[model samples]
Target: MSAHPENRAGLWVALASFVLWGLMPLYWHLLKVVPSLQIVAHRVIWSTLLVVAWLLWKQGRGWLRAALAQPRAAWMLALSGALIGFNWSLYIWAVNAGHVVESSLGYFINPLLNVVLGVAFLHERLRRAQWIAVALATAGVIWLTVQFGQPPWIAICLALSFALYGLLRKLVAIDAVGGLGVESVYLFLPALAVMVWGEAQGAGGFLPLGGAPGWGLGVDLLLVFGGALTALPLIGFAFAVRRVPLSVVGLLQYIAPTLQFLTGVFVFHEAFDRDRLIGFVFIWIGLAIFAIDGALRARRTGVTPVAAASEA
Candidate 1:
C-alpha cells in the first residue's frame, strides 16, 4: 500500500538532512587552506546570529528568557554546546588533514554508541540483536586499532562527544531551535574570543588581506553562510524525527556516513587498505543487524521506533 503523504514528506526531509551531512566534507574541504579553528569560529558566530534571529521571529524574546530562567537546563545546554563545538572543530580538521575516512568511521559508530549510552545511563534494556550489534562494532574498533597501530582517537572522540550531546538534548524539554539558540549563546563568546585572537595574531582570514590564498570574497561568503549550512540540516532533522518512525530515521542516518566514506575513498582518494576495509565491514555488519532488528520490532509492536531508534 501507498504511504501517507505526510509520512512521505517526512521521509524526504530526513533524507535531505542526511545527504547534506554526508556531503559536508566537500564544504569544509574548500576552506582547507584556512585554519579549522577559524572556520569553527565563523560557524559558531554566524550560526548564533542566524539561529537567534530565527528564534526571535518564531518565538520572540520570551522564549529566550524562559530558557535562561532554568539553571539546570542552562548548564546542561552549555556542556552540550561545548561538546558539539569540539566535535565540529575536530571533524573539520579531520577532513582537511586527510582523516576523512577516520571521521566517517566515527559517524558510522555513533548510533551504536548511542545505544550503549542509553543502556548505561537511562537504564534501558537491549535486545539480543542489539547486544550482538554492539559486540560486532566493538570488534571493528579493536580491529581498526590493531591495523592502524594506534587507537583511532579522532573517530572515538567524535562518536562519544556527539553521543553525549544527543543524550543531553534528549533529557531537555525544549524546542530544538530554541535549545540550539541558547547553546549558541553559550558558545558565542568563546568563538568570538578565538576570532579576535586569530585576528590579533595576523592569522584570521575572514576577509581578503593582501591576496591570501584562501582569503577572498568567495571564502568570506562561505564562512558567513556556514551558519546556515550548519543550521538547515538540523532544522530538517528535528522536523523529520518528529514526523517519521525513529527506525526509518535511524536507517537514514547511515546515508551521511556512507556518503562520507565514499567521498573519502573515491573523491578524495584517501587510503583504504584491506585491513581498514575489514574493520569497516565489521561495523557495517553490526549496523545491518541493528537496523533489521529495529524494523522487525517496529512491525511486531505496531508502534513507531521513535523511542527505540533514539540511536540518532
Candidate 2:
C-alpha cells in the first residue's frame, strides 16, 4: 500500500532533522579554535534568544508565565535544563577534541540506556529480547574497556547524562518547545555570565574587544547559527512525531549516530582498529536485536510504540 502524503512528508522531515544532527560534528569542528566552553555558552545564549522569540511568537508573551505556572514543572525543567546544558557542553568539547567516534558510541548506547532507565525509574518491564539486547550491549562495553585498558568515559558520561536528562523531561508536564524554552531561560544568566567573563579575560571568540584575539567572523557566525542548528532539528522532530509512527521514529534515530560514526572514521580519519571494531560490532548487533524485537512486537500487537522526544 502507498503511504499517506503527511506520513511521507513527516518521513522526510524526520530524515532531515537526523541528518542535521548527524552532521553536527563537522559544524562544531569548524570552530575548533574557539574554547569549547565559549561555544557552549554561545549556544545557550543564542538558543535562548531564538527559542524564546519563537515561543513568544507562537504562544504570546504569557508563554513563560504559563510554563512556570506549575511549580513542579518549573523545578523539573530547571534540572533538565542543567542536564542538557552539560550534555551540550561535553558533546561540543568531545567533537572538537577529536573524540567524535567515542561520542557516537554514547548516542548509540542511549536508547538502550533509556530502556534501563525506564525499568528503574518508571517501573516499566522489558521484554525478554530487550533483556538480551541490554546484556549484549553491556558485554560490548566491557570488551571495549578491556581492550583499551580503560573505560570509554566520554561515551559513558554522555549516555548517562542524556539518559537522566530524558528521564526528567519525561516527567515534566510541558511541551517540548515550552520545556526547552524554560530550560534555556534557566541557563541564560549563567551562560551570559560565562560569555562576559571570557570577554573580560580576553578569551572570547566572537569579537576582538579588550584586545582579545578573536577567531574571526566566520567563527562568530557559526557560533551564532549554532542556536538555530540546535533548535530547528528539535522543531522538525516534534512536527514529525505527530505524523509518523513511533516505531519508525525509533528506527530512524540510528541515522544520526551512524553518520557520526562514519564521519569520525572516514571524514576525520580517527582511529578505528580491529579491537574498536569488534566492540562496536557487538553493540550494533544488540541494537539490531532491540530494533527487530520492537518492530515485531508492534506488528503483533497492532499498537504503535510510544514516541520518544529527540535528545539531539
Candidate 3:
C-alpha cells in the first residue's frame, strides 16, 4: 500500500530520531570524563526545564495544569520516571565504561522483551512464530551468559527497565511529550538532590565543586544542553508515530542499535570474539523471525502489529 504524503514525511522524521539515537553513544562518549550519575542528573534537570518550557510554549500553561491535575497519570508517570531514569543512568554508564556492545544488545532485545511482557502481563496471545522467535532470543541470551561466564546484566537491565517504562506509558492517558514532561517533573527532586550531593562531595562535573577541576564553559554548556538533546529525539518520535504506521516505525527502531553495535565493534574496538559473534547471530536470527511474523500479521490484520510500537 502506498503511504500518505504526511506519513512519508513521518518516515523521514522517524528515521531521523532513530539515527540520532543510534549516534548517541558518540555523544555520551564525548563526556566520558564526567560521572554517569552526574550526567543523568543533569539530563533530568535540563530535560525537565526544556520540556516544561516547550509545553508552556506549544500547549500553554493550561496543558501542564490539566496534566498535573490527573492524579492517576501523575502517579503512572512517577513510576515511569523511575524506570527511564534508571535506564538512562545505566546506558550512560555502560557506554562510558566500555560496555557499548552489551548496551546495544539490550536495546536490540528490547522489542522482544516487550513482547514477552505483553504476553505475561497483558495476557496477550502469541502466535507460533512469535513463540519460536522468543525461544531463539532466549537461547541467544543463554549462550551469551555461558560464553561470558555471567549473564549480560547490562543488556538485561536496559531492556527490562525500558520495556516496563513503555508498558506503563501505554497505560497512561497523556500525550507523548506531555507524559515525558510529567515524568521529568516527577524525577526532578531526586535528580536535584543527587546533583546537590555530588556538588557537595566534589564529584559533580557540570558545576565546579570544591575539589574537582574548575568547570570549563564548554562542559557546563554541554551538560545543560543534554536536556534539549534528550527531548529532541523523543519529540521526533512522538511526531512520527502519530503520522506513520507503527510497523514502519518498528522496523526503523533497529537503526539505533545497529549504529550502537557498529560503534562498539568498529569505532570503540571492544572485544568481539567468535563466541560473542555466535550469540549475536542467534539474536539476529531471532529478530529476523520476529520481523517476519510481524509483517505477516500486519498484512493479515490490515493494521500494524500493535505490539511493534513498543519503542520508547
Candidate 4:
C-alpha cells in the first residue's frame, strides 16, 4: 500500500516470482513424459539461450566479450550458474519425487538461512528480536528432526542450496536476466552433454515426451515454457533490486516459500505431524520477528527494501 510505482514494480516482480514458483508443481506435473534429468538439462540449455538472446537484444553484440574481458566477472557469473543449476536440478528432482511439500519446507526455511548467511558472510549483527526468531526457528527444525529420527534432508538441502545461491548472486552487480544468461553458459556444456549422452544411451531425450517415452504435448510445452517462465521473475527481480534494499529483499524472500508450503500441505496433501507443525510455528514466529525488526531498523536508517530481491 505504501509502495511507489517503482516499489510497486518490485513488489509485482516479487509476486510474480512467488506465483510462478508456487505453480511450478503443475508445470512439472505436465512434464511427466520427460526424465527429471532431461527436463532439468533442457531448463539449463534453453534458459541459457533465452538469457543470451535477451542480453544480445539489450546490449548488442559486445556483451559476451565485455563479460569475458573480465574473466573474474565471467567466473563469478559462471559459478553462480553452477549454483543455480544445483538448485534447479535439486528442485526438479524434489518435485518429481513427491517431495514438493518437503521442498516447500526447505524454501520456507530459506529466509532464516539467509539471515544466517548475512551474519556469516556480511557480518551483520542481529537485533535481539531477530536473534530470538532464529532461536525459535532453530528449535522448531531440531524438533522436527528429532521427531523424524532422521535429517529433513530434502528440506535442508533446498534451504541451504538456495541460501548459498542468493549469496553468490549478491556478489555481483549484473542485471538478473543478464546475470542468469551469463551463468547459463556455464551450465550449457553439461546440459548439452547430458542430452547427448541420454540420446546416445537411448535414455530417451525430448522426443519421447508423452505416452511411452515422451511426456506429451503438455510436457513439451512445459519444457519450452520453463525457459520463459524463468526469465520472467528474473526480470521482475532485477527491477526490484534497483528499487529496493538488500535487507528488505531478505524479508520478501518468504513469499514464494509461503505459497509453496500451502500448496504442499493443503493442495498436495502432504502430511504435517505435531513436530512439523510446531517447527513451522517456530519458523513463522522467527520470520515475523526478523522481518519486523529489520523493517523498523531499516526504516529508522532510511534503507530501501532490498530483502525482497534477495531471491536472485
Candidate 5:
C-alpha cells in the first residue's frame, strides 16, 4: 500500500511515543526521594492538567461542557481510567523495583497480545505468518516463565492490563483528549484523597513539605515534566494514525520495546540468561517473518495507508 501523508506522520509520532516510553525508566530513577505512589499521583495530576489545558486551548470551554453531556462516554472513560491507573501504577512499581527488564519484556509481548485480543474479542483473524509470530512470542514468554520458575507475572500483568484497557477504550465513543480527560478526572479524586492520607501520615507527595526533602522530589518534578512530554507525542500519534496503514504502525511498535530491552540489559544491568537469549532469538526471527508477510500483503493488495487520527 502507498503510505498516506497522515500515516507517515502518525508513524513518526507513534515512533516518538515508544521512544519516550522506553526511556521513562531513567526518569523514574531520578525519583529516589518520592514514594512511587507519589510519582504516580503526580503523573495523574500533571497529565490531567496538561491534557485539559490542551482541550481548552484547542476547543475552548465548550469541550469540557460537551464531554459532560454524554453519561455513557463519561462512564466508559471512567472504566478506562481505572484500567490505565492500574497499568501505570504497576509499571512504575515494576521499573522502580528493579524489574525494568521484565517490564520491557511485557511491552515486547504486548503488541502480540493485542493481536490475540483482537481475535478473541473483535473476531479478527490473523494471517498465517502472524500466527507464527504469536507462537514465537508465546514460546519466548514460556521460556521466561520456566527460567523464573514461575509465570512472568510482572510482565504478563502489565501487558494484560494494558491490553484490556485498550479493549475497553475501543468500546467507548470518545475522542483521545475527551476520553483521557474523563479518565484522569475520575482518577484525580481518589488520587487526591490518597495524597491527603499521605499528608496525615507525614507522607504528602508533590507538595512543599518541611523536611530536607529527599531526591524523590526531583523525581516528582520529572514526573510532572513527563506529563508534559507525554501529551505531545500522543497528539503526534493521533495525527499519524490517520495517515498510515495498520501494518506500518504495527511494525513500528517494536522500536519502543527494542529500546526498552536494550535499556534493561545494558543500562539497568538486567540479566539475560541463556533461556532469554534463545527466546529473544525466536522473537527476532518471528518479527522478521511477520514484517516480510505484512510488506508482501501491502504490496499485493494496495490498501491505503491509515492516517494518524488522534486516539492516544
Candidate 6:
C-alpha cells in the first residue's frame, strides 16, 4: 500500500535523525583532542543557547515561564537533565577512549532495558516474549563479563542511565523540547563554569589561549555546531512521531546503534573477536524477539506502541 505524503516525509525525517545519531561517534571523534569534559560542557552551553533561542522564536518567552510555574515538573526535569548530561559525558569519553564498540552495545541494550524498567518501576507486566528477551540479554551481559573477565560496564551504564532518564521524562508533563529547554537551563550555569575553569586552568581546547595548544578553527566550528547537532535529531524525532506509527518508530530506533556498531568496527578498527561476537549474538536474538513480539502485538490489537520518543 502506498503511504501518504506526510507519512513518507515522517519516515525520512526519522531516518535522518537516527542516521545522525548513529554517526555521532565520528563527530565526537573529531574532537578527540579535547577533553571529554570540555566537549560535553561546550555541548551543554551551546545547546542551551540554541534551544532557548529556538523556544523563544517558536513559542515565545512565555513557554519558560509556563514550565517553571509547575515546581514539580521543574524538579523532575532537573533530575532528568543530570542523567542525560552524564550519559553524554560517558558517551563522548567512550568514543575517544577506544570504547566505541562497547558504547554501541549500551544503545543496543537500551530498548530492552526500557522494558525492564517499565516492569520494575511502573508495575507494568511484560509479555512472555519480553521476559525471554530480557533474560537472553541478561545472559549476554553475563557471557561478555565471563569472557572478558570484566563486565561491559560502559554499555551497562549507558543503557541504565538512558532508561532512567527516559522514565523520568515520561513522568514529566512538559513536551520534549520544553523539557529539554528546562534541563538545559538547569545545566547551563554548571557547564559554563566548567568551560571557564578549563580555560583558566590552561586546559581549554577551543582557542589558542592560556598556554594550551588549541585544536584550531575546524575544531572550534565543530564544537559550536555540536549544539545544533544535539538538538536537530530531537526536533526531527518530535516531528516524525506525530506523523509516523509508534511501532515503526520503535523499529527505526535500531538504526542509530547499528550504525554506531558498524562505525566502531569499520571506521575505528575496534577489535571484535569471536568471544565478543557470541555475546552480541545473544543480545541480537533477544532484540529480534522483542521487535517481532511488539510488531505482532500491535498488529493484533490494531494499536501502535505507546512510547515517548527518547532524547538519548
lDDT of each: 0.88, 0.89, 0.87, 0.76, 0.75, 0.90
Cα deviation at 234, candidate 6, in Å, is 0.6
Q: Return the TM-score for candidate 3, rounded to 2 decimals.
A: 0.94
lDDT pick, better of 1 and 5: 1
TM-score of 2: 0.96
Structural similarity to truth (TM-score) of each candidate: 0.94, 0.96, 0.94, 0.89, 0.88, 0.96
lDDT by residue (tens digit), candidate 6, 46-156:
999998999999999798899878758978998999999999999999999999999999999999999998998999999999999999999999999999999999999
TM-score between model 1 and native: 0.94
**Cα displacement (Å) at residue 17, model 1:** 0.6
Residue-level error in angstroms, candidate 5, position 8: 5.9
Off by over 4 Å in 1: 208-214, 305-312
Worst 10 residues of 1 by lDDT: 303-312
User: On residues 146-250, what C-alpha lDDT tens digit does candidate 3 reach at each position?
Assistant: 978999999999999999998998777677899999899889999999998898888875557545774677878888888888999999988878766666776
lDDT of 4 by residue, 69-182 (tens): 653677777777777888888888887777877788888778778889999999988777877988988887898888889878888887898788778777776556767777
213-233 per-residue lDDT for model 2 (tens digits): 788888888889999998899
Query: Each prediction's Cα RMSD?
Result: 2.2, 2.1, 2.3, 2.9, 2.9, 2.0
The lDDT, on a scale of 0 to 1, for candidate 5 is: 0.75
Prediction 4 TM-score vs. true: 0.89
- lDDT of candidate 2? 0.89
What lDDT score goes with residue 254 in model 4? 76
Per-residue lDDT over 115-220 for candidate 1, one digit per residue giving the tens place of the 0 to 100 score = 9999999999999999999999999999988987988999999999999999998887776777899999999999999987887677887664433444777988
> Model 5: what TM-score?
0.88
